[model samples]
Target: MLKLDHITVVPPTLAEGVRHVQDCLDIEVPFGTRHEYMGTHNHRLQLGDGIYLEIVAFDPDGISPRHARWFGLDDQKTVRSNWDAGRRLRGWVASTNDLRSVLAKHGEIFGTEVPLPPENPVFAFAIPKDGSLPLDGAAPSLIDRRGVPVSSEKIPDRGAVFRSMTLEHPEPEAIERLYEELEIDHPPRVVTGTEVRYRAEIETPSGLKELT
Candidate 1:
């Protein structure tokens, strides 16, 4: 039901998020767009092959949403803790065609579908009620773009190409089973670890680099 969409870095603010990504990738990602409905904004960079990296954070100047913001931006304490722990490349998102059916079967893990923009919605995203990472980032976030292609020319391309992604979870077996059930194309490889985290290898203009 889903395919690899993009990876993400959730920071407390846009400025911090940009710095983190720039320091790691050795390139500046151009501003992507703002989420007026979610009260957040982001910077994006293409990782080649239609994949991209997103640095999203809460927009202090934007109006607060009725519900919590996505990517756990509402919880700055945890976001800061994770960032301080060197978990910059925090999570990943998956794009799907049948978001409704997928959520129907796995709402507990993937969360409910929320049509974005509040007005003239163009995309729908799966966000938990508390607006937390899907399974605390153990599982990838789900997005339904209403048949739109995942790869886009809009995002910046600095000659960065994705190589591989490895997801670390304490219960690797459980996460692996979930990925199999979801039939996620290009899903990250699961490995046993003390905590749920993500790491990716990307080929950049400067050479191979790891984003975490």
Candidate 2:
């Protein structure tokens, strides 16, 4: 079975991404390591359960990847455009024990499963080799974590708990089937829109707030 592991917030830059969380939620997000393989870095925050939040962006200092970078960060202009529009919650990742099974079932629609180094200990079914983010980045990235520290043990909590997460896409039926296939609870909503949008309601020290 698959479970929601974390939500990814892709900003134009890591600094701006961190600032958005601080400005909007007034919480300090701890810096996570640089994903050297993907040429990206992130700041992390705990949101109760085994789930967390990652604010990811292209690492300005990291070397370029031989293949297309994950999360569509390969296109600088697109990243800037999204940032210019506003700080929005972009995508999420799901974790499963049987990674191969999940891939075998929906690899084509989900994307290619690229195995990371043993030291890094993650198997990412990122955007397809052609580099198209499925459903315009609304589809949750599939992951298989190997012997990694749990979020509760690794990330320091700053008094925030996830209340719910709502995803919106132009065509919800396809996504609904995907979610059902993966066993996602309280699945995303379908709406008449051009883009996939998401909002995560989190309870913080300042009461409940939406992470958009």
Candidate 3:
């Protein structure tokens, strides 16, 4: 079965992102390591369940990626605009064990099968050359851990549990086709909308909270 691995919160910077999450969930999130290849760093909070919440942003000192960065971070205009307004949720990723077959069935959804950076432990699919996903980024990126267990237990707990995830897109059926092809067992709910949007509902230490 496919699993919801982690949801990404793309802030202008890692500190701002951590603040955003802490403010909403009323829990302190610890920092994670940098993705040298993607030029991004993060603060992560384990959801108690297998899933985790990641607040990722570009690392100023990190080298520029030779290719497009992940989680739509390469788009400085959008990132800055959103950051200026307020830090918020960006997108989510799903994990599948059989990535090769899953990609073969739904490769077009991810664009192309770009190789993961050596530093990235879990296998992940990349945004295509233009750095766009099927519904212009509403769709969750696919990943395969190859039996590597996620260390969610080691992560400091703030009492967050994932409840549901929803992905809205202009063409709901197109996104549906991608899900059907990949056969991800617990994929997020699909909805029709004018533009791509992602939302995740979690039971936090304080109360039910949303990230979008």
- Rank order by lDDT, top first? 1, 2, 3
> What is the per-residue lDDT of model 1 for residues 83-177, given as tens digits with 9 covering 90 to 100?
88877778999998889999889899877888877788778999998899988988888888887675577787888999999988899999988
Residue 50 error, candidate 1, Å: 1.3
Write the candidate numbers in order of decreasing TM-score: 1, 2, 3
lDDT of each: 0.86, 0.76, 0.74
Where model 3 places Cα greater than 4 Å from the true spot, the runs are 82-87, 119-124
**TM-scores for all predictions:** 0.96, 0.89, 0.85
Q: lDDT by residue for model 3 over 2-59, one digit each (tens)? A: 6678888888888888887777777778988888777888888888668898888888
lDDT of 3 at 62: 91
Better of 1 and 2 by TM-score: 1
* Regions of model 1 farther than 4 Å from truth: none
List, residue by residue over 23-78, the lDDT tens digit for candidate 2.
Answer: 76788799988888778888889998788999988898997777777777887788
Candidate 1 structure lDDT: 0.86
The per-residue C-alpha lDDT of model 2 at residue 128 equals: 69
| Top TM-score prediction, candidate number | 1
